[model samples]
Target: MLPDISVVLTTYNQGKFIKKAIDSILSQSFNNFELIIVDDGSIDDTKRKIDQYSDSRIKKVFKQNEGPSSASNVGISLAKGAWIALMSGDDISLPDRLQVQYEFANSFNYKICFGLPIIIDDEDNIIPDEDFPVFFSDHSFSNRKVFKRLFEKGNYFCAPTAFFQKDIIEEKNPFLISSLQLQDFACWLSLSKKYDMPIINKRLIKYRRHANNISSKNNNGRMEFEMKMIYKNILNNMTWELLHEIFPNQFSVASMNDKRCFEIEKSFLLLKQSIKSVHEVGCEKIWNYINDDVMCSILSTKYNFNYLDFFMETGKFNTNERDESND
Candidate 1:
């Protein structure tokens, strides 16, 4: 018989913490779960510790050094449950974590749900909430409202605290292999477009914070580039009405049906957010020209877009000297 939930716990080189993480899952109040452990090339005693677990429900997959997101993907692929729960190998989940989520999902028809994370230190002591950013766990998820919040407030849904219906993964993989730092944020953001992401606001997970933690720290400039690309992809697929719903003041009825105008407006949103690398206002057209190869082909092939005209229309193009030939 298939379990009701599959908890995917992913790790790499966190052998010291993995034992506690595994024990936490094994001791969960809910018994209808299969635990999947994806050890991503941990060069430590991670495997040795996992071997100590003789639980029949525990499934282990050891693969080469493929980063966290890739490891998560492997676990998600092997999940054999109606609902999927995400757990970090370094974090400790409370006893009722799965039961609370399962009951809530069974009652409410929500496709995705997240709980609050109580931050913890290396020795398993609780850290005060004032030290880290607060979790906006109670916000009700509406498609337009949540997308708007994600665009402005960024991700608030705690990653490993998430318990979602497995079917959504069929539509899209929740984890993106390339977005190491923003994988959870990107998944929530992407899923928000299709489902109402709710909050439990109750059950707690000990979100471990340490020097080696991958949850919060920035992984170089890759995050910035990934975010811009996320926005661009959303713009490419989202309806104009949905776009206006997210950014109400940025669109007019006349611009609603105009594809060219819509493209230009999306570029404006990206520019206002400083999503481009140059961090300059007037370079949206130039950024689109250089960054998006597909959009470049479409603009020239379909819109007959004039770069000079488009650049001048924004009115912020700076010039060394404003003369007819130079401008």
Candidate 2:
């Protein structure tokens, strides 16, 4: 029989911190778990450091240099527990972290779970900054509420604090390889679209802050590009029921009753949001949908915006306080 949980710790060249990360899980208050460490082509001493561990609960997979999404997928494929907890190579999980999250998810019957995080530095000192993840609530949210929050506020759920059922990983096969460094955010968006994950009100992980962190937004414009792609993908695939649920009163009740109309009406609200890339993508999507005469007629009849009206609104749109771009 398998362990109660499988901890898939995906590490690259985090040799310096990898031992502490592994030790954190090995010393978890909840010990009925297997730790699978996937070394994603670490050029440093990550492999040699991992070799120091002799714990039977610890398993290892050494592989070539693949991006984060690919490395994580490899680890997910090897998970043997009923539940899976994802830990980054550079961060440290508190001893009670597993116990608290596992119990919380099990008690509430939530398939996916996330915990709060406190940022740490290279010296393992707690850093006081506004960049850390905060869930802002003690209660759980419905899938729709969570989905809407994901779109409006961006990613508040930090990947290091992530925990979920093994079944979800199997069924969804999330963490798109095309998502680049933002696999977690994209996966969260995809999962939250269908499943309700809870944010436990406890601080569980010490998310390390350093120049080498892949989850860093400082990545060479890849973060922004991936985020745009993720948002566009979600909008393109959204059902009207979800769109209507996200924007309750934005669409008239009659429009809500009509799937196509309600779906098209989402572009209007997306265009009004304060996020630049999101609204830009929304504008692009509307233009794409309106090019066909039949869809144009449907949108024109169902909603007030026609081609010229939409053009005027798009022209007047400004997401930022300072509109410096000439485009």
| Local lDDT at 319 for model 1 | 34
Model 1, residue pairs in steric clash: none
Q: For model 2, how does the per-residue alpha-carbon lDDT over 194-268 read when each residue is reduced to its tens digit?
A: 789778878899988784653443453566566668777676667666776777776667765776666676777
**Pairing residues by index, what is the TM-score of model 2?**
0.87
lDDT of candidate 1 at residue 270, scale 0 to 100: 56
Sequence-dependent TM-score of model 1:
0.83
Minimal lDDT window, size 10, model 1: 318-327
lDDT tens digits by residue: candidate 1, 1-327: 999999999999889899999999999999999999999999999989998989999999999997888998889889999899999899999999999999988898888888888888888888887766547433766867777777655666778899998888754456778776677777777778778877777856999888554332244346555664555565568888888877888765756877766776666565564223322332555466645677666556654655664565455434331211000
| Candidate that would win on lDDT | 2
Steric clash pairs (candidate 2): none
